[model samples]
Target: MITTKLYNRYQTVIPSEIRKKISVDPDSIVEWTINEKGKVELEFRKRLTEKDIIGLIKQELPYNSVEIKKRSGRGLDWE
Candidate 1:
């Protein structure tokens, strides 16, 4: 098992082996979780950008500004 010492501020450098295996960079996000058995887990994810979520919302109908204004007048938000 690879081991590293935690500094006074509780910060520890990730070993090169682990870093290479996970392919994490400075911009990567690290998620920490504890299971029922109290085992800690680490997951790495890429940071999200506007381009990544541009089309996340599915559109079934065509866009209509008039319909949007009417819906807004009726207090409907994104129906």
Candidate 2:
């Protein structure tokens, strides 16, 4: 297991190997959780952007203008 020293400020750098594996970089949100079994888990949270949403629609959603209109309720209108 990889180990790191906690500094005076209670801060520790994540190991480079682990960071690379998780695709974490500067400005990434880090999440910490402690389970009932006393196991601690660290995770990197990825925030979705507008570009990501567009890409998801392009890739996964089929063109359904009627369903889109019903679900959106004038949201797509340019008023």
Please report the candidate that would top TM-score against the real structure. Answer: 1
Model 1: per-residue lDDT, tens digit, 1-79? 9899999999988898989998988888889999999999999999875456446768897776567557755888773
| Model 2 regions more than 4 Å off | 48-79
Could you tell me the lDDT of residue 24 within candidate 2? 83
> Count of backbone clashes for each model?
0, 0
Error of 1 at 61 (Å): 12
- lDDT score for candidate 2 against the true structure: 0.73
- Candidate 2: give the clashing pairs: none
Cα displacement (angstroms), candidate 1, residue 51, comes to 3.9
Q: Give per-residue lDDT, candidate 1, residue 1.
A: 96
Candidate 1 lDDT (Cα, 0 to 1): 0.80
